[model samples]
Target: MLGAGSWGTALAIQFARAGRATVLWGRNRAQVEALARERRNCRYLPNAGFPAGLTVTAALTDALDGVEDVLVVVPSHAFRQTLAAVAATGVALKGLAWATKGFELETGLLPHQVVEDVLSGDVPTGVLAGPTFAAEVAAGLPSAMTIASARADYARRLAESITTDTFRAYTSTDLIGVEVGAATKNVLAIGAGISDGLGFGANTRIALLTRGLAEMTRLGLALGARRDTFMGLAGMGDLVLTCTDDQSRNRRFGLALARGQRAEHALRDIGQVVEGYYGARSVHQVASRLNVGMPIVEQINRVLYEHVSPHDAVAALMRRPVMAELV
Candidate 1:
């Protein structure tokens, strides 16, 4: 594992429980030291402790040494830097999977694309995504995820290794759809949170969610992803969970924004990088470049970047020209 944040820690613990010797690497040496000594991540996931066989380390080389399967769990923005470090280490990564769920802002590439570009075409890369919450997964709750790769055998192997009765893993060959669904849903969750903060009723929230699914499907289809993938765990399932749950950081950020807080202030109050904040801009850029009409995503960009009032953002969405549902 190449990240020590909540999700990384939680995943490390999960793999450890499966009797896999896991090494968790953190950018913060002090945080890594504390986790090594205390068996707990005090900052992000205080309630969870490291599994018995899991080891936390600050040394990059130590973590990468003799590791066969590498799971990169860092934030999307930090992926290139982390990959550069991996390249410098000269590790022959055979089976690598990324859990990061956003596009690189500078290059406008998905996580898999970044991996393919950075790894010199040496590694077999895949994605793991779904409706997973770190806290729930850490607590050994039931969760389902999709693992996608171009190679069917690799995807099947990954699914077999990662799946358990509690944690189910499904396989897909639609890597583009899997990634787009995961990235775009974060943007929609922010819209849902804004609705909640504005005291919108459940009916309104349901409508927003429905429309959000449509937008996600459109973008996925345009990107050559199968439409059915958007209705699966990585798409609608994730959107429903993140948008409706108060435990979601992106939704919390949106609520704060609707409550008259600046984006910076809201992020500060939330105390975590809401993927949707960066993801919204990326989605807007991609949609515009592809000529895909994602009006909900456009409104989110306006609210977050152009300082459009939340109320007015809602109005703008409503005022768009009406069309047939399937059009």
Candidate 2:
């Protein structure tokens, strides 16, 4: 693991519980020392206990030493630098998996794309994504996820290695589809949260979710991903969980936005980079470049960065020219 955040810690704990020698590499040496000594991540996931087989280290080389499979769980913005750091260590990675679920703001490349770009020249890489809360997963609650790679065999191997009775992993060869679904849903979840925060009823929320799925499908199809993948666990399952659950940081950010908080203020109060905030801008940029129609995502980007009020965004969406639902 290359991060010590909540999601990274949860995955390390999970792999450790499965009897794997899991080493978590954190950026902060003091935090790593505290987690190693106390057997807990006091900052992000305080309720969860670190498994016996799990170890924490601040030294990236120590964590990368003799590690066959590397899981990069860093924030999307820091992914390129982290990968470069790993490359500088001159460690040969056998198989790689990324759990990050956002696009690179600089390049608009998806997480898996960033992995492939950073670890170029025939490196086997995969992505894990779905409807999972880090806290619940760390606490050993049941959850499901999709592991996708261009190679079916590699995907299956990763799935089998990570899957347990409580944690189910499904394998897919549609890496693009899986990644697109995962990244795009975060943007929509913010819209859903805004609705909830504004006291919109279930009728409006359900409508937004359904439309949001359609927009995601359009974007995915434009990106050459299979439409059905957007209807699967990595897509619909993630969308439902992030949009409806209060635990979602993206949704919480949207709630703050709806409650008249600025995006920066909400993020500061939440104390985490809501990937959806950056994801909205990235998706909007991609949609513009690809000439794809995504009104909801556009509204989100406008509200987030263009200074468009959330009320005006909603009203503008409602006032758009009506079209057939099947379109």
Candidate 3:
């Protein structure tokens, strides 16, 4: 694992419990030392003990030592840099995958694109994503996720490596669609949180997500993604789980903002990377470049960055000219 946040720690725990030798690397040395000494990430995923097979390290080389299949679990912004660091180590990676979800900050490149641009080597790669909460997964609750790669065999192998009695994995070849779904959902999840925070009822929240899915499909098709991928775990499952649930950092970020907290303060309070907060910018840039219509995303971007109030955004959305649902 390349990132030591809750999601990374949770996945590291799962890998260790599955009897794989897993090393979790964090950027902070003191924090890594504490986690190493305590055998659990008290700051992020507390109350979840680390398995015996897991090791916490501050050295990137130590984490990459004797690594067979490496899973990078960093945030989207750090995805390329983490891979570059791995490349700098000159280790020959066999099977590589990332659990990061979002577009590059300015370039709007997906995780796969970052891999291609950074690695430029014949390393089989995949993306692991789905509707999962780190706390729940750490507690050994039943969870299912999708592992997608251009190489079907590599995806299957990664799926098998992490799947257990409590956790299940499915494989897919639609990397474009899977990544599109994964990135787009975070943007919509922020809108969902804004709606819920403003005291909008379930009817409004459901409508927001329903239309959000449609907007996501339009953007995905523009990028040549398969339509069915949006209906699968990465799409509908993740969208619903993120937009409706409070466990989502992006959604919680939205909630805090709706309750009158500044973006900086909300992020500081959350103490984790709010991908949706950053996704608002990247997704809007990509959508505009692709000429895709995404009203919800646009409004959320305004609310988050332009200092527009949630109520005003909602009114702006309601005031738009009526159109057919399919459009």
Candidate 4:
């Protein structure tokens, strides 16, 4: 595990309990030391107690030492820097996987793209993603996820290694679809939050969510992703969960925005990175470059970065010329 946040800690606990030796690394030396002493990540994952096989470390090399598989669990922004640091260590690993779900804000690259550019070796890489909350996984509740890679064998192996009776992982070869869906859903969740915050009822929320899926699918197809992939766990499952679930940071951040909070203030109040704020920019860039029509994403970018009022955004969306529903 290459992060010590709530999601990473929860995964470390699960893998360790599954009889794998897991070492969790955090950039914060003080927090790593505290976790080592307390045997629990009290700050991020207070209820998720660490198992005996789990260890905490500040040294990137130590975390990579003798490990067969390396799971990078850092936030999307820190992913490249962390991977570059690990590459500096020159550790040999059989496989690499990431649980992070957004593109790099600077380069607008997906997690795999960052890994490809930074890491020297041709390590088999995969992504583990779905509609799962760290708290639920930590509580050992039943959850299913999707593991996707360019290599089918790698996807299968990763799924087998990570899946538990309570935690199921399905495999897919549609890496692009998985990644694009994972990235865009966060932005849509923010829109959902704004709607909810404005006291819009379930009907409005459902319409936003359904249209959001269509917008995501359009972008995905433009990028050469399989159309059916958008209907799977990484797409529809993730979209619905993030949009409806109150635990979602992106949705809550949107709620804060609708309630008259600025983007920076809402993020501070959430006490976590609202990935949608960053993803909106990246997706907007990609959509523009590809000539893809994503009206929701466009409005989200304006509301988030351009300081457009949420009400104005909604009004503009409603005022746009009518088109065929199938478009």
Candidate 5:
């Protein structure tokens, strides 16, 4: 683990549970030291105690010392920087994968692209993603995830290394599809959260989710991602989970926005990185660049970046000219 955040802490617990002697690394020296002393990440993953086999480390190299597989679980914004540091270490890692689920903010590149650009050799790499919430995984509840890699062997290696009885792993070769779906769903979750916060009924929520899936599929297809991948765990599955679940920071952030809170204030109150808020602008930019028709994403961009009222955003969505549902 390369991040000490909720997701990273949760995954470290899973790795330990799976009988691996896991080492979790974080950038914050104080936080890593605290996790070492307390055996729990109280700040991010409160009430979740670390397993005996799990060791917390402030030193990046210490965490990678003789490790079989390395998981980069940092935030999307920090993914490149952290990996750049990992590359600089020259540890010659065996199998590497990331659990982060968004694009690089500056270059709008996927996690794999960052890995390829920063890292030096042909280090077997993949991504672990799906509709998983860190809290549930930490609690050892049943959860399913998708591992995508260009190299099927790498995906299998990562899946076998991390998968536990409670945490299941499925593999796919459609890296672009998986990543595009993962990054785009957070933006869709914001749309769902806004709808729910406005007190919309089931019909409206379903509409948002369904249409949001279409928008996601459209963009994914434009990016050369497999169309069928959108229906899999990383696409529709993750989208539903993030959009409907209250534990989702993106959804909660959208709810706060709908409840008349400023973006900065709501984000501060949430106390976690709302991936949707950051992803929305990037997705919108990508869609625009591709000339893809992503109305739902457009509305979310207007509401989040352009400071359009949530009500007006919905009204605009509703007012769009009707067309065939399959378009």
Candidate 6:
């Protein structure tokens, strides 16, 4: 594991509990030392502790050494950098994957794009995503996620490796749809949070979620993704989970904003990476470039960056000219 964040730590614990030796690495030396000494990540995943076969390390090489599968769970902004480091180690990796969800800021590249830009094509690659929270997964509660790879064998291999009694894994070949859903869902989650915070009622919230799925589908189609993938775990399932739960940092950030907190202060209070907050601009950019009309995403970009009020953003959505729902 190459992140050591909440999700990374949780997955590391799961892997170790499955009796596989797991090494977790983070760039922060102090935090790494603390994790190694205390056998717990006090900052991100305080409730979770290291299993017998799990170890934490600061050195990237140590984590990469003799590993069959490398999972990068870093923030989307740091995805390229972390993968580059992995490549620089010159390890002959059997497979690589990420749970990271968002578009690379300037480049608007997905996790797979970042991987290809940094490493050789020979490396088997995939993405793991769905409606999952780190705390529940760490607690060994039942959770399911979709693993996608262009390589069918790669997807099956990872799914087989990670499945446990409490965790289930599904497989998909629609990597593009999975990634599109993962990245776009966070932004919709923020919109959901804002509406809920404003006491807009459950009716309004459901409407936003339904329409958000449509926008996600449109963009996915434009990018050559299977529409059915949006209806699967990585799409509707992930969107519903993130939008309805406060456990999502992106949704929490939106709640803070609806409470009238400045975006920066709201983010500071969350004290974690809110993928939607960072990805809104990039998502908007990609939507515009692709000529896909993501009205909700556009409105979210304005609310997040242009100082538009949440109320006004919601109003704009309500005011848009009616069109066929299937469109």
For model 1, how does the per-residue alpha-carbon lDDT over 1-327 read when each residue is reduced to its tens digit?
989998899888888876788999998988888998889888887888878889988988888889868889998999988999998998777788888988888877888888888788556678988899998888788988899999877888878776666888899999999999889988888998999999988998999899989999998898889989988998889889999998899998888887888888888888777999999999989888889999999999999989888889889988988799995
Clashing pairs in 1: none
Q: How accurate locally is residue 8 in candidate 3, as Cα lDDT from 0 to 100?
A: 93
| Cα lDDT, all candidates | 0.87, 0.89, 0.91, 0.89, 0.89, 0.92
Candidate 2 lDDT over residue span 116-231, tens digit each: 67776677889989899999999889998999999999988878877777898998888888888888888998999999999988998999999999988888888889888888
**Residue by residue across 171-268, what tens digits does model 5's lDDT show?**
99988899999899999888888889999889999999999999989998998899999999999999999999999999998899889899999999
> Which regions of candidate 5 deviate over 4 angstroms?
none
Instruction: Show how many residue pairs clash in every candidate, following the order shown.
Output: 0, 0, 0, 0, 0, 0
User: Positional deviation of 45 in candidate 5, in angstroms?
Assistant: 2.1
User: Against the hidden true structure, what lDDT does model 2 obtain?
Assistant: 0.89
Pairs of residues at least 3 apart in sequence or in different chains that clash in candidate 6? none
lDDT of 3 by residue, 3-33 (tens): 9999999999998888888999998999999
Cα deviation in Å at residue 109, candidate 6? 1.3
lDDT for position 106 in model 6: 86
Q: Tell me the lDDT of model 6 at 145.
A: 95
Per-residue lDDT tens digits for candidate 6, residues 1-327, read 999889999988887877788999999999999999889889887888789899888999899999999999999988988888888888889989999998888897888988888899598899999999999999899999999999999999888888999898999999899999999999999999899989999998899899999999999999899999999999999999999999999889888988999999998888888999988999999999999999999999999999999889888988999899999
